[model samples]
Target: MAKELLINGEVITVNANDEIVEAVAIENGKITAVGTTKEILQLQDEETRVTDLAERTLMPGIIESHIHTTMYGANVLAVSCKDPEIRTLAALLQKLKQHASTIPAGQWVRAWGFNETSIEEGRFPTREELDLVTDQHPVMVIRACGHLSAVNSEGLAIGGITRNTQNPEGGEIGRRADGEPDGRLIETAHMELYQLAAHTRDEMREAHRVASAHFAEKGITSIHDATGYGLQNIEALREDAMSGVIAQRVYAMVGALNKPEEVVRHYMQLDICTGEGDEHFKYGPVKMFLDGSSSGPTVWTTAPYTSDSGNYGIHYLAQEELDALFIPAHEKGWQVTAHAQGDAAIDQLLNTIEKALQLHPREDARHRIEHAGLVREDQLQRMKALGVIPTPNPTFFSEYGDGYVTNYGDRAQRMYPLASYYRNGIPATITADCPVADFNPMRGIHSAMTRKAPSGQVIGEDEQIRLLQAIRGYTLHAANASFSEKETGSIEVGKFADLVILDRSILSAEVDEILGIKTDRTIIGGETVYLRSKEPVNV
Candidate 1:
């Protein structure tokens, strides 16, 4: 159970001539060579397990290209409305009345990353402020753009919602200027208040093992799970990645964002398709939802939104309900997607994936676009002639790049272009839709090379990129968006050693100190699940 090598490192081998190389080599778990450190230590023996890397910065591990992993592992065991720790709305109702006085009385506290523009009363916390965080409990909260939520009036009398309910056809329910039922809830009204306080199967298997050990301590080995709803989040991520309790590596896309036979006619009546499983869970692409959340105002944009006034947001399907689920899952071979972020929901998702590739002409149908979030240079030349895969989420440009230039004005310089997806040869990927941003792939590679925006504002300086194309947009265009780039993105040979060592020298940090560079080990196939402290070596 040994045989790795690693050596005095810098590796960054995001391959195809983007090489850096110093040393590499792993055995049975793949990557068996990459030169120097004296030509790979002359093929070490005696069950070699070297790993020197005193020069730190070995790459390729970090492929989140659109997440939601069981709703960020049940919002990492819920009840913390994020952002500088609940900034204000009276500190998110005093941390929801101290977590609803430690759960009891009619259960369900729920919370999750709330963001009314990182609070200070920018809004959203009333339902009489989550029933002043308790009225025999039933709170809710949500909204760090999980398509809004609010609840608590004992959650509209436990989801019998009221004020003559009605809205649900692409959702809304906010109402209150004498009509009542204002406990927010947008987009299919957050799936029946998230299936009425779900979260059980042993608390979602310890919230996907604390969201896969907090995404392998931010080195995130792999993940696609865009939360398309049913098949119960791909059967609890293929039974928590087949019992090793999910320590990364998963694709899991399935569908159902409000019925269509709960995940496309029940997975086109099984027999598996799209990329299928094994290698710690696979089977992705089939998901839906055609707009909303590019720093919320509810996306679907084709103009109007200089911060509201006649807002052209909210589209939510009806291209015949997204060609009744992405054209027969793109002609029954699978690999299709949605959750677009407005270019009028990426033009109704490129006119239903160009009419399902002109009535089925499939062939590497990468069919993604999850969050192109406002792209439009002729929709990036028709998503580079329909090969379409642009996962895009560069830390949503450092957490909502100044409310994306005050709500899509000047179209926030074609948001999420990532240097126009590497100047047109688009394989572009990069994500972190975590509990809504902060999955930390070095702050999505320094917000794709400083498209900066924590007030020192630089939101989309011509869509900045480069720094190994923002580290191959989270490692090899996020493993070509789950076709798994010949199995696990870079430092390539036979792939999957699934690297990432880093402590410094991401080619000389300082793009706002690359998310304060850290992570000291997070392998995967070649084990070492996550270390966090290991440096000081010489030989």
Candidate 2:
């Protein structure tokens, strides 16, 4: 194969194999040379492809440790209320009433990212308010936290939920002060009806394309997508990969919530793990959520919530139940990540994981603790001792900081502890719990470094990580968490040529201006997937 040289740039080589170099060379789809311009030019020939760097920074492609890609893509193009004007009960109803003319009556009209804290009047949207929008159409507005949703009476009836209905094992049906079904659905296990909303395969595929384009434009080379909807999503991803439309490499963690274990077993039957297929796509861990979001009333907490004292959210997996299912799954050598937000839930998970590790003792197991949000000082040490990775959604700072404040008060301030993870030697990877938060790495990086919430509050100033650390949280640590570090995380010899060329160097940029750094180009395996300007270069 012919050589390709990238010259004249500040290269941040995140690989130990190569020092920071002024130029790099790629032959086929792997790094051939990484050094000074003169050294890279030594490998050049008439057939070589040379790219002028324009003095911008060249680095390993960005990786999102945790993102729900297809879901986020569909949600991006979904018909719902995200704009502030339509966030409230009255405004949402008005907006739905406006759009209802097109849809047939009695169809489910679902919208996502509705925050109760965003409502100026300051209260959860009631069933009555949703009814005003459309009794004919069952309108369900999911909370921004993904822990709750408010649905109209028609939707409640459709789901077979009623005032007399018991709360599901790991979920709840929010009730009014007068003891009525208040139209709010809480926890993953609680919202079975909403899970049924992703029935349209075509819509999901379209959304996946949009979502992928969004990441490519921002220079994301890889993602650890957690929302495993089903075989349909896997098929969609496969189709995109085969066609070369999906440029970003993906490490998928199949979820087993309402999804059958047989489905997970089916994927396991594929006998795939780290670096399963060609450079672009692979399957990694199996994901399970033990609780819900901290900003919503579903995260099982140690004490009663400071806001709502009577309510301590429930746990999804009972001890005996987990022992039966989770233990066996872990013993079978499946890398697992559990969504345990509240400290108590995390403690339960820690205990469960410890037992499994003792029984299994697979050194390279690399199991993960998803969300792993709230932790006591003692728990931090335990996490480090266990060698568990925390895939934190620091994007929560920018997306739901205010909601967290309202939900947990002082406790919320310490949520998403980046510095704590660093201090305890726990390798942490940051992410956007997308569809709930925007799946933008810049947003995640900004939130981690600044700890500045969308409401402009510095929620956890002490917990704020440095810009460099924040970058690694998305890149190196993210790759490690997914067990893809060997092949993809860093820019090194024999590594796949996954690279991002930025218009500005993020490492040297002013702290506040880092988010402004845009991607001029994105390359995967020596192929330019996204190029902003193709005008002839001066060099």
TM per candidate comes to 0.35, 0.91
What C-alpha lDDT do the candidate models reach, one value each?
0.80, 0.75
TM-score of 2: 0.91
Residue-wise C-alpha lDDT for candidate 1, range 1-539, written one tens digit per residue: 36778888888898889879789988887888998888898998777867789777898888887887777777766677774667888877887788778877887888777878778768887788778777888888888778778887888788888898788877788887898887888877777677666666777778888889988987888888776357665787788887889988888777754552467668877888778878988888877777778887688877789888798888766788788777887888888877888888888888989998999997778888887778888988898898888787768767678888898777887688878777889887878778788888887777777777778688768887868887887878778877788988888888789887888778977677877888887888888788888554324
lDDT of 2: 0.75
Report the CA-based lDDT of candidate 1 relative to the real structure: 0.80
TM-score computed on alpha carbons, candidate 1: 0.35
Error of 1 at 472 (Å): 6.2
lDDT measured at residue 183 in model 2 versus the true structure, 0 to 100: 88
Sum up the clashes in candidate 1: 1
Task: Give the alpha carbon lDDT tens digit for every residue of 1-539 in model 2.
Answer: 45678898878787644356788888788887788988887887778778888678888888887777776776565455678677556787777777666678876776777776677766667888878877678877777776677888888888888878888867778898877899887775345767665546667667777877888888888877776466667667766766666668877777643543445667656656434666667766766677777777568888888778887887777767555556666777777667889998888878877888888887867778888877777777878877788888888888678767777888876788999898777889888877778766777888898887777989978899987678778777888887778777677788878888888667678877877878888877877778877775424
Off by over 4 Å in 2: 1-3, 17-19, 102-107, 132-136, 176-180, 188-190, 242-245, 256-278
The local lDDT score (0 to 100) that residue 266 gets in candidate 1 is 81
